[model samples]
Target: MIERPDDAPGAGLSFDYAGFGRWYDSYRVEVLDPALVEVEAVVGGLLRDALSERDLARIRGPVGRVKSKPRAWRKLSHRRYVDRIDVVDDIPDVIDDLVGIRLTCTNRRDIDVAREVLDALPVADDGRARLWLAPDSERDYLDRPRPSGYRGWHVNLGLAVDVGGSRQPVSCELQVRTLLQDGWGELTHEDTYKKDGELPPLVEVLSRRMADLLSTLDDIAEDLRDELDRLDEAAVTSAPLPLTTETEGPGRRAAQAADAAAYLGTRWRALDRPVDLAALAWELQRDHGAEITDDWFGFGTFKRFLSSAVPAAEITTGRNAYILPADPVPEDDAADDAGADEHDGDVPDGDVGGHAESDQTTRHGTTGQGTAGPGTADEAEAAVPAAARALHRVDRTFPLLGHDDWTRLFDHLAEAWRRTGAQPPTDRLARRLIQSTRDRSAASGPPLAARHVEAVVRDLVAEGDGVPRPADELAGTYATLVQQRLVELRLIGARNRNARAAVRRWIAF
Candidate 1:
């Protein structure tokens, strides 16, 4: 346990921002680092032993971090705390949450269970532990959030460490929150937007409104879980027979399952280009006894099936995987040539592999070199999709798409624009999407595969019900309508030679 000295010579001295800094640097290296390591080891081991797999899955993160040096100094420099202290000596004595762990859960019940587990843990004689419930001000936020819209529970614990035979207690803080509260808090983090712990009036009002909306969403999630449970019970009683009964042998069943996904995938690509994921999910539940949730992995499985079956699907692995439409063949070739030419000419003076190149320009603006530029092409070509996807506000529900699904979509869009002799949409959303892909590639490496533009077009398209339909029916009608529109435009533009040329260029493809 860390204890402050009361009778120091410079007791009650004014805040010395530099004085605190000098001691903290050395203290951190010699004392804080080693102490934190031991405490974390103890806590981590305790958690591993105590929690079951199901309990562990319920938790999002049990991440621990030492309070950064700068943040520590900022706390100590405060006049109120320093004024109470006699010559502020140590960082730990001033800041209670020197080492901290944060845990996020899906609901209030999970939060309570986690807290109970922590509270029941054993502590050695050398250590001291204390847990503080949020005071009235904070409690109100949990029940009815504050103006800043922050809602979470905080607990502070101090564990004793033996440094060269003497036992010293180091402080650690634990924060617990529901998933909804955690998401809102992260998006509007105090450190990111608020300086000096103050929010502008407008920001405060908006945040409060967001908090209310988030609370409503949380309630909806709870309702959904309840409704799903009722549905699950109904499904148990009346659901179709097991999929295995549909075929005679296990091998045949497996083959049929695979074939079903492929057949459905073909229809989806031809009709919608991108698979109608919701329809796919419904089909799986209705026919195949597969339960799909809205989580990343659940949706990812759906995408995986679609990608395998449909030429349009794209898939990626790891935490931030996603799918989008594929790139056009001509646009891809054009961009590849452009990227290759740029790479050859633009190698910086010192770096070997364009390492020193900071801002490599592309058709999408200044993304680093070796990147496919933005709009549809950019999404398919991004080496790291997470950063780019975040920038574009892409849905994060699915972790992977059918492989090359995004590539096909991009290619079709590019081809359509080219054939029409009209530019593809280059609005703010498109630019941001492109810029993000480039930025991600620059930071990371090149993408897993260079998106291929040339892919076979299928005649069968999937309906919203995930059923196959003939593309010829729609294609013939669509072509005739477009031709009529083009003729009308040509007749109107007959008076202007330039307009005629533009119209001809558009329809020539």
Candidate 2:
């Protein structure tokens, strides 16, 4: 979709610097230097904002620079249709046409981010941006690599701005990347891999190996950076400790210790005081060391210890844990209660109260009637028969319901429960309805249909009934119900559907 200018060779006029430099100097001062200065300032400002101080410090020289060189008349002179001298003299647009800017970055990812940032910037009236990953007009050393074997990201941008009241197109190349990659590229450029000729087989192999190593190093560095961010987030919410040092230590080991201590301290502070501070300290040290040593601790030893040592009520992850006042009823439950009250006198049959319904159901089919009003028992039993008929009807109507149709049906059931006094026949009935709706919807059209079912499942599991579950046990129960329904509907194939599984699958990693 992006329209690029045709760059076929010999399509435009070229000029010899020896003859044109003198004549062009008389008419127009070289403006490429000033344009480059402007680009450098912009790029440096962007880098400062996007990168941390440590990363910024490592960058060598200016982030970007521009260069201008006149093409040889012989190279530029060839005109399939016109002489080079005539082409230059007749074409007034040839002056100030050749310009380039090179940007150097620390790593490939950084280079990508930099390119995105630059492309997002407001463009000049006549400027267009283009990127070249390897050697091209801007950088031509890919075939003949440098000794150090560094590769850089380069961009050739053409400016359409009018200079000195003349309508002329100018080109600038921008290069970006990490200091390490830049260093490697520079070394390779200077040493063995200049553009003179084809490189030796040994040099080629070595260059490729070095390139792989550079990529691996970058990946490792990025992972470390991500871990550091996680540690920082944990640290901010932690309580200030009297025994803790004000200055955090350097490297991964120290970061891990600080993060562990901070996490434990924050979580434990909500409990009664005179806490086992020494034990906490020991746990932090042990866990921190274990992460680095990897072999020091058994798989779940540290986790188990932390869980047992801390108060279950105080320990929270993935979701918040707050104690609600006793008898605190969730809004949806309250709504359900209010709805149930409206149908109190209208009990289906054998209904002593709503509490008895949950007691009758078991993993295996054993139906013992709880204390329901004599009037409600007949209706409740009749409702079950009606639900069975409805399920049979749905099965016949849609033989192979996909994911989305099943979701829609379940949504319909849930809405029906809320709006009307109709209760689903059983949890099994609700599960079937969900699956049938989801399947029908998926079979309807686009590939996103299945994804939509997944989204709804995720939302239900994450924030059930749009109310926060205060206790882990309560949350786990609701999560399990949702997971069970999803599995029954074939939306989520069975593997693991425990508390930890729910957290890992639904919550953002």
Candidate 3:
């Protein structure tokens, strides 16, 4: 009766312990691996959708195929068990599961975009996320940069997911960044974020400085990219002219070819043309003439022409050449000897009368055909010189007046002055003259009388005397002049509020 039972002795207990060990191994294989796989697939899908929505093409490849690798576990053998005999209680409540995704990009901006895309993803209520750019990552090694200098972004996300049908949750981690950052991280991860005395003081300081320098260099590169974009836009918008039969009339065509040759040849000459006149003229003839002829031309054509005809350095430096039209002469006069015979005309004998006739004759020879008289040519020529000189001065002083139209107008005024022997008009008078001329041309009619231009000029001069005209005040005067002309042309009523407002804005800088 006192003999040990077959199922109750030490031998039976040993067999039970062996069976429990086998069951624990089976749980890890069936439950833990599959749970981790599911979590990884869900998170990966979330990241891919976010990046795709943001149009971040660079991160698409890396995010779409992310996975959790090599499941890891920590055993809490001493912890309380759920049941007296259950081994599941020995497992820790939170598993330190880690998953990461890597992205590659050409520039740092792409890295930033990836980081933003990840942050925007919908996270579980119990999850937490963090983002780091460049140097903040573990892979960033300032002391030793990679040969390729690949820089990138990083993100650390903490997610909580259900496992094994348990009410409790497990924690998981996620990381995102570029290939360059990943490489850098791999190299320096051990030395970074060490609480122990792993990283030496000197190395840490040097690493920080190098990181700062690299960041600054990246910023500079971005700025250069922006500048290149602007230059490309300018080039596209400023392509060369075209040539066509109607546009390339024999006479104009010859003149255009000669002008182009002159422009190319003058590259070696000093840029001291009397008013950028030569440069303005050449552009007009080449651009407008070729356009008229329906001849297709581009930057390459102009560049090639300049390369052969002009100095290489001048063409490289972008020095422009202009070819102006022959200065407009009196209807009956020649361009070169226009005012030379002013004193030869029949004249009344007196300083007042003779001087007045001589002045009128000189003005007549310089003004455009059919636009000269007692007061017309004198006022027109007077304003022309000052406007031309002002434009020239501004071009040299400030960097404005780069527009071809503005420069061409200046050249025309200078030519008029040269042919008329006229003095520069006051600024007020010059402004009025320009406005009147533009208005008349737009209406396909003759300009206002020179006396009328003079009156407006006199009013402006009086107003501007001893006072710096605020930009608005000057603009207002031009607006008034435009409105008055528009009304005189009978195209619009004087009371048109919309027209007045538009003119005001147009005349404003």
Whole-model lDDT per candidate: 0.43, 0.37, 0.36
Candidates ranked, most accurate by lDDT first: 1, 2, 3
Q: Give a tens-digit lDDT track for model 2, residues 1-509.
A: 11223343333434334455565454335455545555566557766654433345445445343322234222343343324235445533332223445555544444534443443232333233321121122332322334435556544544443467654444455555566666666655533243334467777667668776876787787677557544433332342322223332222245454465456546555432112222343345444642422311211233333443343423223321121111211122233334444544432222111111222111111011111111122222212211111211111111112222333334443443343333334444344434543554335432122222333333344444432222233324533544443233222234322212422222111
The most accurate candidate by TM-score is 1
Best by lDDT: 1
* Model 2 TM-score (2 dp): 0.38
lDDT of 1 by residue, 331-423 (tens): 112333334334533322111111111222111111111112122223223222121112111221211122133332333333332333323
For model 3, residues 360-473, the per-residue Cα lDDT tens digits are 112121112112222222332322111112222212211111122222333333333334333344664455444644454335433333333333334444444323344345
Clashes of each: 30, 52, 22
Judged by lDDT against the true structure, how good is candidate 3? Answer: 0.36
RMSD (Å) of each candidate, 1 decimal: 24.4, 21.2, 27.9
On a 0 to 100 scale, what is the lDDT of residue 348 in model 2? Answer: 28
* Model 1, global lDDT: 0.43
Candidate 3 lowest-lDDT run of ten: 348-357
